[model samples]
Target: MVLAFLTTFLATRFVTHAIRSGRGPFRDASVGGVHVHHEVYGIFLLLGSGTAEFAYRPGGGWGSLLAVLFGAGAALTLDEFALWLHLEDVYWSREGRSSVDAVLIALVIGVLLLIGANPFDADRSAGEGVVALTLLVNLCAALVAILKGRVVLGVVGVFVPLVAVLAALRLARPTSPWARRRYPAGSRRAARSRQRFPPGRRNRWDALVDLFASVPHGTRPRTATPTEPDPEHTR
Candidate 1:
């Protein structure tokens, strides 16, 4: 219960902080086939955590801990599902191929999480351990996908953390190199490099970093106002 509240409180506060600091919320270009409004996303994550902890039931050995973990995971998965239900426009803007690829990745990982000993259903003592371990694995997988430009893959990678990790990665991953380069200053890329690659990569996040790094900084796309603020504010 406390963890969920803290997480939600911290996440919400962070977004508020970003906005106050002049980093107002912006739309995410990699919406693929689903859209997630940032406001609602935070609400659900906070609620999910609360519900999961409240639903926790004690059990023997690893059973008790697993109960709490599953409840929590359920809360998180519910939050992720909400993203799919609420936002279609942002999720589907990319190439058809990327959307399809993301679904495939989700299916594969979802199956893995559901099967393979079912961490959520483990003995209570082992459940906590299982949840923790799976969370680690999920985090590693998500990081790998983000660096590789697999936006959909990264989004789907959060199953273990009830999609929290995936959400976190989305917020953390650079939206565009141009934006980042400009924000920090002194990090500008040379002009000759900008011409070699397209401005927006297949995924907005990738293109931003890749294009900026490959081409000169001046030629990159200006950070347009986002259509909807990013739901995964942690990134």
Candidate 2:
């Protein structure tokens, strides 16, 4: 299933980029007057695979086939994740980068699970209350990290509790909801956060993300306004 998802995602990205560049025979498909997006095909594939799996409860090779189909479908749907996220066609806009982030996050979690990382692996000897408490603590820590704008860390913390705890302990990004609401304006903590994560700062993750997709993805031009630098999303 993982292989199928990765293969389909790579192929879809290649074809879409080729079409955009007019570098190959790949072209956009349309039905009547409406242009069709690849997510449509993915949605159908998911429905068919899911329905077959549930109705027939197939095993062995059939089960594997369904899993592959489901994985491919997921990749397709998530490739346009930004479109559905904002209820608009932001596929080539700056916001569209979220689609890439979504795919990367999915890939990370899927691979982690495949490699035997389990978030629910509590000690059996521990009482149910202990297990429940641990789960709650982990959940709260992950939520805090997310609110602090450590999105990747928050997600990873679900699989690794320590990661979430550490992220929650760290200072929130200057633009994060947590910082905006909790840190008073002009406060020392707010100033420190802004200094730590200045606007337009780039990191290794930014380069890694750009490696998978084209830059400028048809981002809309900004209108004339204050010349202040734009804030960057801390991936």
> Which candidate number would show the highest TM-score if scored against the true structure?
2
Clashing pairs in 2: none
User: What is the alpha-carbon lDDT of model 1 when measured against the actual structure?
Assistant: 0.42
Candidate 1's residue-wise lDDT over 1-235, tens digit each?
3244234434533443343344666323236434333445544544654565467633474444444444344333432342355444222223212333432344455556546624345465456776788767877766655553445555555544445454434422243443344334333233322332346535564453232123122322324346543443311
Local distance difference test, each candidate: 0.42, 0.82
Q: Best lDDT goes to which candidate? A: 2
Write one digit per residue (lDDT tens) for candidate 2, span 41-98: 9999999999999999999999999999999999999998988899877776678888
Which residue window of length 10 is worst by lDDT in model 1? 211-220
Q: Estimate the lDDT of model 2.
A: 0.82
TM-score of each: 0.26, 0.88
Give Cα distance to truth, residue 86, candidate 1, Å. Answer: 10
Query: Which ranges of candidate 1 are over 4 A from the true structure?
Result: 1-102, 113-121, 124-235
Per-residue error at 142 for model 1, in Å?
A: 4.2
